[model samples]
Target: MNENVSFYRDTWAEINLDAIEYNVKSMVEHLGGEGTVIAVVKANAYGHGDYEVACAALEAGADMLAVAFVDEAISLREKGMKVPILVLGASRPEDVQVSIDYDITLTAISLEWVKKAEQFAKEGVLQFHIKLDTGMGRLGITEKEELDELIQFAADSSSLSVRGIFTHFAAADELESDYTDCQFAAFKKLLGGISNKEWLIHCANSAAGLRFKDRIFNTVRLGIAMYGLSPSKEMNKELPYSLQEALSLHTKIVHVKKLPKGGKVSYGATYTAQEDEWIGTLPVGYADGWLRQLKESEVIAGGKRVQIIGRICMDQCMIRLPEKMPEGTKVTLIGRQAEEYIPIDEIADRLETINYEIPCILSARVPRMFLRNKSIMEVRNPIIQSHSASKG
Candidate 1:
């Protein structure tokens, strides 16, 4: 247990703020002022570091910031971000005043929770939005009678302010248009428009944002796409604007060993040397979000592509380097190097998941070095990467 030996090696994720602005510009250009994009910075801005991504997004003209919880909003607030933050998900009733103290808006569908919030709010003022369950069947007011009263109360309340009305699309990105249209129609019927209070009404997520321009809600919740990634494969195909992958995972080779053709590598001897080859160990692994499912995957090393040999370990993974490169060489798990690039989507596709999880999973233990214009712009505080995170 050496004091300075970092358990993580072999891979790390890179994020570029410059590309973030580009992605925001792409979406705004495609929108052409049809609607406002409320950038979703929840889940630590989808694992790209919430404050940094949120700052970058605001730099690119994102109108508002949305999060899934109160603490996240509080974090952005702590960073001195003066932009409006709307908690798009759960906010415990006990913490309503804390939310108010931070000037954050909480989402409420239950009259009970609203009443609780009203109790805690100072000056009887609690700015919050009501989430409607159009079809997602998630957290939101679903019953008609409840929704009507909630709307009326919001309109009449002196203590509560209805900042906006919104809903989620269950299938906005699918080619099958039936479900999306249904959700939209349901949301429209529920919110014909509130009188007296001119709140911004928005309901389009990334998928709905790109398609159904005529059906544009008052505001769009731009999540995955805002970070230069898409919600689904089909949407990527139909994207009206070119998207750049804002987050890149990179690391350097710290240790290289030349193994004979018969050498066994990693757990289970899953990978045997294919002739005499160079095996290099990176300083990070599945613990850092380099999923073990990518056991047979490849990472860009020394300007050339190399394969991850054997089962990915918990704190580190091994890649086979070429004779031209050795210890101390840089390996690219997500970004570009010379003529080769490993987009995050490729890894997601390889693992049968969405690209959103890649950066999020790169535990906080691995440091995120932010880049702007291809140079180190800033290094975020150390990621809380959990090594005990079930081994890769």
Candidate 2:
């Protein structure tokens, strides 16, 4: 073990901050100064590490940051992120004072929730954004009357300040524009009722901002795209700018052996060697987000794609090696090796999921190594940190 290394595991996730910065800059360029970009760093920046990605986005010219809830915003605040952060999800009435103390903006989903929040408000004004339910059946004010009432109520309350009004697009990633057009129309109709037009008006997420530049108001929430991923598989071809993926999963082969032709591998003996083949065991499994569903998935080994074989165990998995690879040979699970590459979308396809979930599902057991300009900047190992805290 290296003297400076704290984590014992060989499996790790690598995040390229340069790629994130590049992606953010590309989105800003795509906007052409017409609107501001609110870097969505919720869900730990979609599992890319919120603080690291948030700083990269801000450095790349993102104007604001947005998270899913109050706790996420507070976590950023505790990290000393002073950027304007909007909680896109509804916040609790009791947490209103906490948000105000931290200068965190929240979403006002309904008049009732706002009234409750106002009752809890103390000492400082609580700023919020009004959410309109254009078409999505999720949280927001659905009717025009309710929206006007909420708007007027905010205007009347001295403790509350409405900073923005926005809605979400349900199918903006699809090639068809009918649903998006309908939502935009509804948003416009709702906008007619509000007297304060200066509130930061925004309704476009990554998909809508990338596909429909004409429909954006003055801000766009940059989420998955800012991490260099398409909003959906269907929108891959429609992306205005080519995105550079920022995260890669990798591990070192800890053990290698040659299996006889009849030799079986892993838990269920589901895999039998067709020929005398070299097999490698990786120190990664379901606990590390390497699910059993990816039994036949391919990973880069020896500069070529090789299939994973047999039942995946809780702590390890086996892969068929093309040649005799020594222990500690680098294996690329979700990145490029030589001329071959395994994109996140490919993993998502194997699991029948979205690209966003791929990184988010990566468990904290795997240390994240952050990189900038191809050099490692920091290594965040949650396991080691927790262990140290327990020891202390």
Candidate 3:
């Protein structure tokens, strides 16, 4: 069976659409089939390939797609994603109109930004969410006077329409309402005075959509939980439904060699052979989202788990495969079968980080394959706009 594997091949990131569709449908149960939901596909769908995952989410009934910037929106538009896309993050002041020109809605917080958008408008109205900050202390306006001023400005400006008013929860996924309730109360207080405008008053993200009963919102922008990842560790025990992971990563052994006892391996000689044993080099490493900190973890190979040894290099990592395993053995960096699974959660746990970083860190050099109905559908080439690679 090892003959089928090519040692020279590059590692791959695999996406399962069936599971993605299942996750979206399960998450959208509360949004109802009619209510709008904006799926955040900014980081190439968290490195799952935006176009591929966007289709799955839309197929599962997502009302719109959301991203962080104009460049990302253009990528989706270039790739034929015709669904309405809203830039949830702030649009560059210089490119505000560029976003409007491409039919991409922006999240404008000030009258100046709204006016900047007027330069590109010739006909149909340009839309954007008025972001309000309650607790996350991020890019949002918390001052009621300023928010009211913006609202008043929008009322007079026919070119701009207040599509939505939203705020981020400080601790919704923590399952604690102390701060969440405060944020909600503040959002409600702000919304109470605003009248007849048909703006989508939304604050609930994935956690609120799943746990909270009174969502009190027209639309929910789901990000992490849509990919079947719990927003935080606290929600793990409280989740009433099982969530299926949508991403799976796999690679094959590139080299298998037996070393003498006390032989040191890899760069820096950190891992010394305790006994005469077999070692297999995997072609997946930090470059493939397998961070160097995960050197303490293990990789599944030959139906058994193998510990990663020594320092992880840019394009390769070494795992202590069984002495009996033949060369070219299939290595599973992340999978879901055979009494084992290396889903993103596991990697996150090993690294003591969030699930978002796992997929986001996978280098663009790794080709992502999209699978639908348990069959190979298509391959999305390396992302060209990898400018956000260093972030998070």
> Which runs in model 1 stand beyond 4 Å of their true positions?
1-11, 122-124, 383-392
Give the runs in model 3 whose Cα sits over 4 Å from its true position: 1-10, 119-124, 383-392
Instruction: Please write out the lDDT profile of model 3 over residues 1-392, one tens digit for every residue.
Output: 22332223656767888888888888678655645677889998888889889999999988899998889999899888888888888776667556666788788766666666666565667788888888888878878888888888877877777788888887888765578888898888877777755777778888887777576477778788877788888898988577888888888777778888999887899989999988888887776677889886977887778899999998888887677576667777877647777777888889888888888888777777778887778775545335345453
Q: Could you give candidate 2's per-residue lDDT for residues 84-163 as a string of tens digits?
A: 99999978899999999999999999999999999999788999999999998898998888888887888899999999
User: Candidate 2 versus the native: TM-score?
Assistant: 0.97
Give per-residue CA lDDT, model 1, range 141-186, as digits (tens).
7766787787677667777887877888888878756898888888
Give the true-structure RMSD of model 2. Answer: 1.3
Which candidate leads in lDDT? Answer: 2
lDDT score, candidate 2, position 182: 95
Our model 3 lands, by Cα RMSD against the true structure, at 4.1
Cα-based RMSD of the predictions, in order?
4.5, 1.3, 4.1
Would you list the clashing residue pairs of candidate 2? none
Which ten-residue region of model 1 has the weakest summed lDDT? Answer: 1-10
| Candidate 2, superposed: residue stretches over 4 Å from native | 1-5, 195-197, 390-392
How accurate locally is residue 231 in candidate 2, as Cα lDDT from 0 to 100?
94
Q: TM-scores of the models, in the given order?
A: 0.92, 0.97, 0.92
What is residue 219's positional error in candidate 2, in angstroms? 0.2
